[model samples]
Target: MADAWLVVIDHQRIFADPASEWCAPRFAETAPVVARLATHFDDRVLLTRWLPGTNRNGSWRAYFDKWPFADRPDEDPFFDLVPTARDLTDRPTVDVTTFGKWGPELAAVTGQYPHLVLAGVATDCCVISTALAAADAGCTVTVISDACAGSSDENHAAALQVMGLYAPQITVLDSATVLA
Candidate 1:
């Protein structure tokens, strides 16, 4: 798809908050790359914020329970998007309540777009999850390597390999490769 939509995941206040359960210092590192891409392709960009919620008594709760700090109201902030990413969302930003964005929340927000160029924080989690989902939905998915930050470098590399092997539908490329 020549006309691809850029998708940015998470990069929210909760994740960006140094006090949050899954905060990553490297999230700030991708700011420049994300800003450049958004500037170049403003109309096509779609940013997503993770709306934190309770898993309740479900199986998912078990995982979240282990990290109860994330569920605290204080951990979820009003301005969750990184300042850099927040500026980019002036074009369009979707509030996704779930980990995987394949549901109606994103469908109602995204309207129609064939290509999904994904970037943002926690590559092994939200970024990886959304990439596979978007690719399965028939969109051409490409993960902007440099514009994405994982909780750790090893996790980021592992996520890339996992996505490459399992989600062959996705194309893994660095930000410069696509932005240039």
Candidate 2:
């Protein structure tokens, strides 16, 4: 697994909290799998948090306007990684303001790895976005299906199918297969 890296995307309190409007269903189940993956990867594991800024442009500005509740306070716990999913590794956590983690900040750290195993919340959103960007960046990407939670089951399945067709470099598999 020397060339492999596990990237855990947006498993934050905002998505894990059932009361939150942006909650991702089945986060309770997804958390354990993410934790296990972190344990398996140890130093090779990297976590990403979505940190939206006050300033926005284009559709993003409209998006924020539509869902003002999505604007979390700077110090809100909603932005933090889920309790059980935190502290699994000592690796630095990457924070991004977009749906994908393949931005300049993350690219600099992940470019060295040839393979990336991804897990986290909203499988149809951030998970898929990051997977595609990673593949485009020349990394062979594998998305841990069961370890990811989406807004709904249908969306999760559809996103995986969409990602399957997006590129040959992206593969969707269960965590057990990758961990084995």
Give candidate 1 misplaced runs (Cα > 4 Å): 73-75, 109-113, 166-168
Tens digit per residue, CA lDDT, model 1, 1-180: 357777788778766777766876687788788889887776777778776554466776786768666665524564367777777856556765567665555666565446678888789888888878877777667888898888889999999888787455788899778867
Clashes by residue pair, model 2 = none
Best candidate according to lDDT: 2
RMSD values for the candidates in order, in angstroms, are 2.4, 1.4
Candidate 2 per-residue C-alpha lDDT over 18-108 given as tens digits, one digit per residue, 9 for 90 to 100: 8998898888998888888888887888888888776678898898988788876656777988888678768678887889887777767
Find the candidate with the highest TM-score and give its number.
2
Q: Pull out the clashing pairs in model 1.
A: 12-80, 13-80
Model 2 scores a C-alpha lDDT of: 0.84
| TM-score of structure candidate 2 | 0.94
- The lowest-lDDT stretch of 10 consecutive residues in candidate 1 is 70-79
